[model samples]
Target: MGWLKMPLREGVAALQNSIVSELQRNWPALVTLTPDLLGLEYPGETTLDFLEAIRDLTDSGMVTCEAIIISSNDGPRMVDAALTARGRAMFEPKGRAAA
Candidate 1:
């Protein structure tokens, strides 16, 4: 399925995976979510949809967004976002100490 066309759970999972991957690549640095980083055009998705996906990550103790600004034109702007240890674990190879 397309990025935004997936079921809500799967879409959120995909979004989380993307966020984790980018954060993992940068390691010690944080990210500010941009359209380029997000890399998807959620045509039918709303700001709440974006926020809900992000909320899922934060609620699961996976990642953190220091500043989440709701843009009137855009959606949510996730500033200074970073993965937690748990989020990093998602990228670990199988059999590695991911927990």
Candidate 2:
């Protein structure tokens, strides 16, 4: 199963895209380290669904964000599960599992 995660946004505009896209566009530096996500404030794209477009890339192993492309010190980052829940595996509620 894919790792479920989300970026810590301060307001509405930052949370525009899903978390997956954030991983791909900012790569090589930000990296797909698994269980350790790079955090950064996300910017908006004019011609793309930044999050939905590359949702599957992260599961393949690696994904990057555009922010990491230009800078060495990136901020908060978003993740895939919060993006669209496309590859997430769900089970019964935790409380019910013990029953």
> Which one is best on lDDT?
1
Model 2 ranges off by over 4 Å? 1-28, 31-48, 64-99
- Model 1: lDDT equals 0.71
lDDT (0 to 1) per candidate: 0.71, 0.32
List TM-scores for all candidates, in order: 0.71, 0.20
TM-score of candidate 2 relative to the true fold: 0.20
Report RMSD (Å) for each prediction in the order shown: 6.5, 13.4
> What are the per-residue Cα lDDT tens digits for candidate 1 across 63-85?
88788877657656789988888
After superposition, candidate 1 runs with Cα above 4 Å error = 1-10, 46-48, 95-99
Q: Please give, for residues 6-99, the per-residue lDDT of candidate 2 as tens digits.
A: 5423432232333434432442234432212323233433212333333333443333334312222442233222321222222123454311
Summing lDDT over every window of 10 consecutive residues in candidate 1, give the lowest-scoring window.
1-10
Clashing pairs in 1: none
